[model samples]
Target: MKFSQSIFLPIAAIALTLSSASFADNNQRRIDIDSKVVTEHKAKINNQRFSYTVATGTQPVWDDKGDAIATLQYTYYTRDKVDDRAKRPLLISFNGGPGSASVWMHLAYTGPRVLKIDDEGYPIQPYGVKDNPYSVLDIADIVYVNPVNTGYSRVVEDKDGKLLSKAEQKEQFFGVKADIKYLAEWLNTFVNRNERWRSPKFLIGESYGTTRVSGLAHELQNSQWMYINGVVLVSPTDIGIKRDGPIKAANRLPYFAATAWYHKALNANLQAKDLDELLPEVEQFTINELIPALAKGGFIADDEKRRIIKKMAQYAGLSETFVEQNNLDIPTQFFWKELLRDRGQMVGRLDSRYLGIDKRDAGESPDYWAELTSWLHSFTPAINHYLREELNYKTDIKYNLFGNVHPWDRSGNNTGENLRLAMAQNPYLKVMIQSGYYDGATNYFDAKYTLWQLDPSGKMQDRLSFKGYRSGHMMYLRHADLESSNTDLREFIKAALPKEGQAAKY
Candidate 1:
């Protein structure tokens, strides 16, 4: 799961309401009999005003296993300003975690408004958010959705609640495939209801949501009929969790080192200015250097082993002796715990921006990352205000945007297999990836490593490009960094569109 979600931006004003609870005289359906304003909120950023709406789900969405949930949504719309039907793209976006809502992305990127971030990396303490003049809403119609159980999107039930199934439940919708599949169906229904069927469509997902899009791209193609032209994956990680089988996993150590180096926590030096440049070196070293050394084991000649280990030590930014001590295999969790361990500090496994020291000599990891604290409760109001006051959707339940992973229900995957499926089906579809140097969870290395996994033609590979920034997973919280990402994303979007001679403009 992501450490936090992007913020949910609303288009205009804010108001929330709750109706009288009324059941359909059955356990399956619970409808509120009456409705009234429950709450309202708003934000103004960069001289623009954004609003949100909050409501409860009057009807139960499910009752399989988990808890009965409800739903809440944030919407943004631009009428005349949006590109005409010929050019407009209706982009639906969300974060992963199957448990997370759209807050992090909404607050950080894509939304018409953004929550200001403090130097330590979180929405400001006074709780102020504002309109984003840089918002892509000027070009496309966008909505940040929280799934059935994450954010305020929930399901309320009488028997066992609307939720069904649990972890490793790969066969149930509660997992990966089901959540996205349902979203697709619901979205299709929503579009048909709203008359947006003709608009071009796009999906922007981060982390697990990247995995979600990998499948959604295919689903939208084969069954959904919402043909998509572009997908922007921010730090993808849908391949089988273990990478290579368990035993050979040690061979991929350079990736962890590269991740550490990007965070500036590693001492090893390779001649590359940033992650984008260093990736090739790491990939090469992993093949020509580290892989060979690992194969030799203790039987390898001493000088050759020494040469590789020294390079490894420098590349990994760990003490040469320490590298030798561990036999060149530093586990991911250990690296996370050790990089700053000596200083009695630890960097977050989720978002590297959070740094903490062990409170005791026992070397315990911090209770939570700094950003996690901000995600705890700050986003509810943002969604609430956006829903009722602006786009004016009505409901009466909490939106469950984040929840436990129910694999049984997951639609497809973020694996190399699925990405290729999407690309192969839509040869012209373009992929753009953005990574954050400080994102240890879905490190940039993982995305770069996927090059070998994909079987696309050389031309397709050539068309793929990636960008890495100095910030963490939700990097946009950093204003200047956001401007840089925005500029590049906009340029890429223009080039990928159907236009033949359009200049890449932001």
Candidate 2:
């Protein structure tokens, strides 16, 4: 889970209601839910020079009574002097945390600007922004939206200049269903306002944002009557897939093997084989052998259990005794701690490549997330400076890297099935998943499993694709994957666009 900002709002004002007093001028209190600031800029992306206009602003989120209840902050980038605006592709991007800002993707992934991190993604000195050489801006117009209470986004006072009741806040914007519901409506208004109704539309989200976009796929089609061309899920969650008991236990092996291989902790023969070669063998064992053995549990024969234990130890780089003691269900934390215990360090949860030192090596999990702290160190200053200096969107509001969105309702998460239903209904719709091989939280193989479960009948298999990377959760942070992932995205967008005069039929 992401950390919350220390500042807490009153229960009645939990919607992150902005005070009208903040915008006061000449002692006249006012509010502007639909204000904006525009700036012109130029960048060379993919070796192509282009002038672009960035509109950084807030758009109103209206309530059922035709009143604005909240304002979502968004930054949109459009190539200037485009001859045919209707034909351009518009990519809507978001990052996860349920409470996270859209900063990750905005400054580190697909946007024209990226952090000044090292080639391998560690924070560098004099942290700042640089032109992204691999941005997809040449092929698509992009918008990064911050949900309520994230970045500069905030819920607003009601018609009477009073904060909404707690019930209204929860019912409006704080749960799985509610989050998707409002965001779909918000997109509808955004498209209408920007006259993007005729453009080829795509949604790209990472982590919990995967659930957001997945549910939005169905919600937009069913509720808002808006159809999208493609959906990209990066380092995706299960998206509400049911992976209980044996299935869950078996799924962790491939990730363990990948992380182990990266750290060179595997046995000599397994280490000798390339990761590409070793993973298939482990995956085959996981699906064909491990899942079944785990399903048998205590009922399994002694010899079969011992054999499974040995294979698991070899692949996982753990002692067979420990595997046996855990009864074949090894916790991921234990794996992270135990993997490099001899070296007096622990692996990161999000990216195993990053190492951390613990106070004592006696814990099941590391003292902290080695990757997240490093990310915040680099991302915080970069985004804060970029918004004010480059974009010229001035505001005194503190940008919450991770806002207060707890008591977040996780119920009714049927987004995976929802995406399936959306695909079934919209013949023009296609899906692509991007995963990092070293992402332990939402491992790569489980993403493939989500793909498999999404279309069990394999009817839309042709429209589905999966791409894996060598880095962790935010794979694009690495220089090589940055170039390759953007290329994959460009290809996917072009492939998903319907041919001229083509029918939306199977």
Candidate 3:
């Protein structure tokens, strides 16, 4: 799980509250809810001027008995004077970190204003924000949603206006199934309230957000009768924990080669080739040699083992002896440290192009990811400024950019299965998976493996497509990749929508 800043409250203080009858009856209590804050704004996309409305606020989630259980916070942007909801698409976007807020996706790429940073996404002194000419607002109405407990979203107070205890809040909204249940309910409420029943709905999620969207597609279909047109997965990580063996190791080979190629750590022949040229050779080697060799385990001959070690060293930028010592399988974490150990530095797991200095270079993992630090530095303040100063939505609660949703229950959930079922149920539902070539966290090849596992028959293969960027997990942090990604997504959205006369298939 991603490390995030959190506030820890003593369990003893809330122990009595947990035992009290008042706490038990709190769910039965009724409370008056407030309306969301809506504001108007103007922006230019593709050098064309357009006016939009920014609605920043929370929507109450009510239970079957009509009591408010939780409130989900969102920043919604809709084009003004667009009367035909059926023609305009609505894209609901979110970030990962089971605990992360939606601010990363909101301010960094999809929203009207984007954070200003260096070309490679490093933080610049005197941080600034700029208008995003590639904003999706030109084609789709965007709603950036923060799951309950992230951003300004929280559980509704009791009739007497008393907030629930931390334990109670966790019980309500912190697990896999629980999260899907509540988010599906919240989306249903938002659609009914906004009268977006006819809009071509799409979901865009990054990292764990991809996991959420996968399950959400199924849940929304069954529970809310909501069928989506498309889903955009950014740096997806839906491979289940049970499937982590030789296949996982094999899947990571291309990523290791890509990272080594980026830092010029590969052999002279590999170094001379571009990343595009080097990765295909590594991927072929992985399937034809590495997976079979690793699957053989101790039974392989010594010469064969030596040959595998040499090839691994060639692709992974490690010594033959080091690769042999690790049983010819170099885990990604070890590669992070080993690849640049001679230079007294460690490469980042999120983005291998990012280098960081460790206190001691002998450790298995780097001290921290430099890219994550750069992201937090730029996104945190930018979101706070946008919410309060620009949109004028004031709140005393500290925005949970990254909250404490640890011990996250990851049980009995497979979004790939959900994705498959959704596509089978709704034939027109298309999927677009985007990945960063330099990202070590969720390798592009691994994402391909996951998608391959989903569709073995090639029947729905045409419905799925992929695009790779020369970036890390958050590819949009870089300018060139951001522009390319916007264009790619725009084309995908246009293709996924129904034709003018034909009704939405969903």
Candidate 4:
């Protein structure tokens, strides 16, 4: 899974005390299925009163030969009193971790209720959740799915009641192709079981989930015969050309400038300009001067290299001498540490506005990411409480918020190519890409570069739209960005709707 630098942390083993007797008896193992919980609720969103039904449970995932392999946990919210199911749209959502639960997006902004964090997205003690007035529930019915091994989802025993070993389970759903295959199958099962085949289907994925949706789009259309109407990507990664050489460094320049501007570290003239204006200038410099200079390397004249370094310092908010000493290549980690080193602090790689106090001020990297810790503290407890208390779902299993599913096989994982193919196969498919200005994980500029590469002919440009937020990776954590994102999504969904008498047929 592609993650932001800060999001990937050490995985502590969850204590699951299973008896030796139970482990020894393979035939005694049986499939455990939780009862589905259904509740009716009403909320006033955007000043409009809406009633919806919330269903929380697990759906069985079956293999090709009619054998159950995994059970995926999900929370589905469907608006009540919708006469024609065919007319309403259905959105399937998930977050990335390759092992992350869907709780972040579910409880933060997309679901009917959102966790009550501070305006700046910092956690408040005694974490609580309330009706999210900006939720997308008003526009479409949503299903927040926690992929296998995350949340309450788990691999199950075979039809013969024989449990598969951990290695076997990993072989089934831990790789890029296997993950998409199972998810696509699970989606098919859900839509069929719920009688939502005629409804226009859409997908919303964040971070690595973006990569999942891009690949799933093609997989669904080609393998499962399921055509989707739209896909909404938040903090997308793996869409652009591989981040290496001068391209990688070039893609990061805008983020550096944004980080510098946020900290007021840029030169007086650059700092005086509005972010909208300053970013374009930085982007121009990166493409016209910085990229070319980096490509030429030592072949470039000494004077030109010196001039480029000085200009880079002006935009990146670093000293000319410091930039020169590094040979004009400043990685993101170094920038995070060096940006605020003078004050004995480090900026967060996930969100540059967040400041952290390092144990040692002279280190190349901070000890930990303050922003990630802050979010985990709030989200972890809030999700647990909401699931048990309000949702009425009972589970003794420790929810795997971010499981240890690393060393993931990335072979044949060209999601950008998959997206392009999906678009070509289904010309009516629309896409929306959302990015946060302060997100160092997947830079907004890098996403744009990926889009540029996706549509070289510009024929599908009108169907593709981009929205920017003034927040970080989890942009919706900020209330204002949440509102803005919800509004833009509402518009995008409306625009993506089929024209009069042109509804899609599955």
Candidate 5:
């Protein structure tokens, strides 16, 4: 529900209309669930030129009876002529949306190809991809995965050539646990078939995919006996970490300050300070002063309550009266709408740097998301062009950009604990979190909180690290972040790998 604003938009009116012929092709021209289309390519990454083979294909997800129920589409990139690939690391990448396709990271971030967007992360007229010199391919092979109902991934027909009922499909692949379970099994098959069981493996996920990979970290280890070396969470979700009401409310202040600072809406003194200088002060106040004040609720004295409101208003770039009117708790939507109300504009939920105009300037929230539309304008066309024209994987089946994967069961979400448990079991496992300061959807402060709570015993603290960017949810979209983020990943991968004679013991 936290990520529903960006990933889980309503799709009741759009009919699925997925044809069975798309899957059961006899001509061998169209792609099927059990198909593999290999292509060769070259790219210059990190100033180093190299050729790599891209194996774009669909792998089946089998049921308990060993029957294929669904297929997941994936693109794997491995450097060419690597005689000792067993020592090379493989990075398995996923984008969040519970229902959104993997195209975001596939075309924008760590992929060898990047969308032709501007340096500041805006769409351009010519929608296509260019060589990503910052891609981490120089150090590690990468694979981008599209889960069920996303991208070209779809439900498979039964042995009788009939699609399974809608109810059955949801039961198998449309929930937190269900998603983790099937993907782990599918990964086991992928590792075995590729003969890379000895290769060091890593998992990287964004947004809701963070939840998916966090769960998968434990699921793959415990269920399939697949041990991974590292886990990277980009613009992470709560991963089932519990935050009480007052704590949640107090945690939002630093994000408000960051967004306000980006818009130049903060007070003159606060606005003059750099983001790095400003955030720590706000963060200190939020933890030491605000959280306790909020917990007192109506029991606090009037003078104390008034003092808290003034500071909240000052930090959030809102009027004292407005902060007081909201009972000292501001909803993110309301902040998005009210931030630029006088200018007749609204900030984006995912990336506040993008602005939107509402039908009326008096609304509580904007009419639609500004950042998502901007993202689609570029990503949709570039991915379509790159996959078909460059990669040469052709198919008539329409790619579901943001698939209809709702009625998504969010129960039993203990994935945060699962990651901790997984780390406790595997001493070699390490984690790195990347978050954007301007990402209102999954605020950077909450990401820090999630990491802090991930291992309460503090034993795994040394294995964990956090990195912050100045952009939003998809931080790599910005040209500056693209370079630095990949560099961080390169460093993380190298550090997480064990020394030649090192043991896997604490």
Candidate 6:
């Protein structure tokens, strides 16, 4: 689902020992239903097919006496052959937006395979296609969950035939706490039915999904809290950052600047040096130098801090005076223009994967996320086609890979550090953060910056690993980067999984 303006929105596959498989032909273009209410999806792609299901369950909205009111749908994907004895790693994946679906991650990064983008790295194909050997399905079973009201998932209505409206959905499902509670119950049942209770469970969330995982980790710990092996957070958000506070707006500045330097069309000295080093300095400069300049709240000291502003402006690849004019508090929009204006272009705010040459200064909130969208549109259909024809599944509704995520719950009021508190309570729950160096939406540096600010008091650095890739947020879209990320994920999974012989004994 799209988060900001047009910029946002943000899979797992089962394993197949075989390199290639045949599509189901006539049987392929379909979905399998466990019941009238629950439907499963299976796709065959790249001649190396995988499968998944969209199963539905209900969560009680009140005390035990009442009928269950919420219908929750989660997408489950696993290896073709799951070893009963092997405590296979299970990752419950979710996207951001609070209102987002699991499609982006499912189709792009964590799924068994990926859709190919064009050379400019936008989602277009000569209709070109490729295999994602780096797909994590080899090591872990991935579940891309579309929280109710997203993707094909939705709410449970009264037998009286009540349909859910946008307002009703928000009233029922938009909040994080209730969503996680329902998900925990739903997952518990799904696991029991599938007999996957022995698996080592993990959660991988991007952007706001990261927020969901954090809280759910604790909710699972305290409420339905079970044994969770680990969590992989991509581009996380701190409640403290999202909430109204002295830090919310402050934390975003560095992120904008960090992304600005990487948007080559913007940075005048794009060829200057390795951006990896320069970005952190920009982050540090924003926090250590520029933030205080803004916080000073006085004309005289503010003037003196021009030196700091000069540094920030310089590091951001923007004019020093621009920083002065905005008093080092430039909003994210300005960065897009200031960095690229010289080239008669404006970088994007969404994925930061595109460049838009804008001649006018003002317009509606511009979503330059086409860099990401264009890449997936061309190939997602092919992948979906393969899933049905080659893999064993059936469906009536057409699989919606990705689309407009509107009326989202951007008013994030999820406070109560229970998520972090639970994480601290369960020292066993580890986290791995994978970030794209160039992603502007949830900048990698911002991810780290917010993490440090949260101060996970448990000294859990070993449990939390952050890896940087050369591409944008969906690093897997790039063949080379996905391979490396796959290797890293495999290692991570290996560490979390039960050792070979320890299966039943554990």
Error in Å for residue 121 of model 6: 3.2
User: What is the Cα-based TM-score of model 5?
Assistant: 0.94
TM-scores of the candidates are: 0.76, 0.94, 0.91, 0.92, 0.94, 0.78
Clashes found in each candidate (C-alpha, N, C closer than 3 A): 85, 0, 0, 0, 0, 29
Report residue 247 deviation for candidate 1 (angstroms). 11
Deviation of model 6 at 124, angstroms: 2.6
Global Cα lDDT for candidate 1 = 0.58
lDDT of 2 at 453: 92
lDDT of each: 0.58, 0.88, 0.80, 0.81, 0.88, 0.58
Q: Write the per-residue lDDT of candidate 1 for residues 1-506, one digit (tens) a residue.
A: 11112233321132222222324343533323212222233434334454432222222232234323333343434334233565677777878775677677776687665664564455555554565656665456666766655654444433432233344233434666666566666566556745777676777888877877777777777778677778888767644434554224444454555556655755434544566676567667777777667777778788987987787766666677877887777665666666666667666666666665556625434555655655454555555555444434444544444564444444344445665777776755777788776666776656665644455466577557888776767767667777777677666666667766643232
Candidate 2 per-residue lDDT, tens place, 1-506, comes to 11112222222222223434434442533334676677777778888887887888878898887778888889999988899888999999988899999999899999988999999999998989888888899989999999988998887776566766778788888899999999999999999989999898999999999999999999998999888899999999989998889999989999999999999999999999988899899999999999999999899999999999999999998899989999999989999999999999999999889999999989788899999999998999999998877776666778878987777999999999999999999999999999999998999989988889999899899999999999999999999999999999999999999999998888
Q: What value does the lDDT take at residue 64 in candidate 6? A: 43
TM-score winner between candidates 5 and 6: 5
Ranking 1 against 4 by lDDT, winner: 4
The stretch of ten residues in a row with the least summed lDDT in candidate 3 is 1-10
lDDT of 3 by residue, 1-506 (tens): 11112222222322222113224444453211333566677788867687878777767776666666666778899988887877799999988899999988788777788887887788776765778888788899999998876888767665555676777666667877778888898899899878899899999999999888988888898889999999999999863533477887778878988888888998798899988888889989998998998898899998998888889889988898888888877788888998989999898888888898999978888888877886788888888887876776666678999877776878878777878888889876899989999899988888877777777678888889999999889888888988888888888999998776765444
Overall local distance difference test of candidate 6: 0.58
Off by over 4 Å in 4: 1-31, 159-161, 503-506
- Candidate 1 wrong stretches, greater than 4 Å: 1-76, 79-83, 156-172, 240-242, 245-280, 295-300, 361-367, 374-401, 404-415, 500-506
Instruction: Write down the worst ten-residue block by lDDT for model 2.
Output: 1-10
At residue 396, give the lDDT of candidate 3: 62
Winner on TM-score (4 vs 6): 4
